[model samples]
Target: MKKLFMPYRGAALQLKNHVVMAPMTRSRAIGNVPNELMAIYYKQRSGAGLIITEGTSPSPEGLGYPRIPGIFTDAQIEGWKGVTSSVHEGGSKIFLQLMHTGRIAHSSNLPEGHQVVGFSAVKAAGEIYTDNGMLEYSAPVALDEAGIARIIDDHVKAAENAIAAGFDGVELHGAHGYLLEQSLNPYVNNREDNYGGSIENRRRMAMEIVQKITASIGADKVGLRISPFLTSNDMPSYEEAAVHETYVQLAREVNRLGIAYLHISNNPGIPEKTHQDIREAFANTIIYCNGFTAETAEEKLQDGSADLVAFGRSFLANPDFMERIEKNSPLNELDYNTLYSPGEKGYTDYPELNYISSITS
Candidate 1:
């Protein structure tokens, strides 16, 4: 059997195949809670060995996007239970990705009485979509020491909630200029305190969150996603050397903690040396995601570069993604429209190959 289709055995993860469904926010969670529609959507695409859920806020303050789900509330947890149960019934493990959007948000998206907060007061230079339409990024309230502590606690509680909701584990959204990434970027984090300044100081928040979460839940049930050198979400470019060192150090620290996996959001901008350095530093399952076809993903697995490969758009468009790959069938093109719009038109309406074949016959 091909490596991509082969079962994987690693730290607390046993799966049907090596393919992973990368987390992509679909904004279908009406009222900031998961529902039956979301459960059906995940169950349809449960061919992957593991499914990391879309960015779910760990707290009310972290709901930075319109219609994104949260796991911090009782109703949210109950809603996610249906989704997790459906995925498990299809024989796939699922992890809830805890994301705090931080400064990459507008106030209108957040719940009443909850304001945008981040490592620093600096505002990201981009507009985020809200019910009121495109609005400038909200100026973040720089987290004092107490605020930082509370955020960390929120992440720990969310992880616990995920397990209660029937998730196999939890993945921390430490990338894409979210709250965790905000602290890692020196340009955004201008504090002189211990949580900012030098590389160690800047990375303190992430380390603290990871350490606490791993302690709260076993290390083997936790994963983190990172996108180094990604300038998205209005993240300013910093010294390249510093960027390389920051992640390498983080990899080493997490490795010491014996976490489940490190998900690297593949970017063309990252140097080969950076990849090699991260591969060497972190001695566990490393998932490489973004723009990988099945052929290229197999090549990555065979070359020993990535233990598992994650697909975002492929799974988004094709519910039976594994069946299509095995049969060498053409994939359905993704509809750019309704990517985040409410309802099931472009979301769950994508046809499976079997359904298409029956219709054509």
Candidate 2:
């Protein structure tokens, strides 16, 4: 139980404790650029041992949601510099999560001349919120061989950009039915080439991206996030055996590469035995996230099931989350309405434990 508060070292980054702040999309970046407001929000939550930022696009075409941040342009790089510096000054390490929306994107959300592309021409089933209102997703252009090569190059460049922006590492968003996940889905990827036949073929693109990112920046500075059989974002559900086979193969490959860590988006609902299998297969640092409380996290740590635990909504609403756990203090309830809205109302407005007396009795 005491282990959750102890310092731990991974392949490249050192953390003060085991509580990671999971990556979540907060559509606060106006004009697709990071700003001082975003920096302030991250700085306020620096109590986290590590912060995996909201999904940030690796390129212009990767932009899916309105106002989501990007890491490609010079201005965007400069903007993230402010964020990384702020988080560092407060004594926390941060990793940028690179996400490509694939067929899940709305054309209006992207820049001029940019079109949505995916593993195949299938349209993801869902609506994305825009300035006007909810808009249906459009079918994407399927990538050819040259297109696949370009995507790999884009990922490598984004990884380098992340380092330049003062991020300690970069996480490839391989989950949530995004570009990488779409390729992994048998139902979505109907290609005949080397990239889309068997399980190994389907996993090719994801593996290639991981390899490229690792080559560009040492494996120690890269992490991959995967959510097996996640249904969100129009991702199809696979049989339990298929899910296990696909993820385990991925786990074994990444483990061989000796990447920094594997961040598993494990809801408590996932079978415990399956989680253990992947854990043993990787045999490296694992950060598990999904509705974990202080007690439950401590239990996982004590049982050696997880090396670190991630807090999402808890840390989102409580800037002093670690301190709150230490003191057993009550947490502020999150206002869901303001989560994706612009400005600081539901973001930096959450108070620290010490600030309560100044705000009220």
* Top model number, TM-score: 1
| Residue 241 local lDDT, model 2 | 83
Off by over 4 Å in 2: none
Taking all chains together, each candidate's TM-score versus the true structure is 0.99, 0.97
Summarize candidate 2's per-residue lDDT along 1-361 as a digit string, tens digits. Answer: 3777888786666898888999988898988999999999999889888999999998898897889999999999999999999999999999999998888899998888999999999998879887778999977999998998898888899999999999999998998889999998988999999999788999999899899889888998888998885778898887778878888899999999888889888854466667878888886789888878899989988888888888899988998898899888999999998888999999989878788977787
lDDT of 1 by residue, 1-361 (tens): 8998999997668999999999999999999999999999999999999999999999999999999999999999999999999999999999999999999988999999999998899988878988788899999998999999999999999999999999999999999999999999999999999999999999998999999999999999999999999999988989999999999999999999999999999999999999999999999899999999999999999999999999999999999999999999999999988888999999999999889989999
- Please give the distance, in angstroms, between residue 101's alpha carbon in candidate 2 and its true position after superposition: 1.0
Error of 1 at 300 (Å): 0.3
- Listed per model in order, the count of residue pairs whose N, CA or C atoms clash below 3 Å is 0, 0
Q: Candidate 1: TM-score?
A: 0.99
Error of 1 at 305 (Å): 0.5
What candidate 1 gets wrong by more than 4 Å, as runs, is none
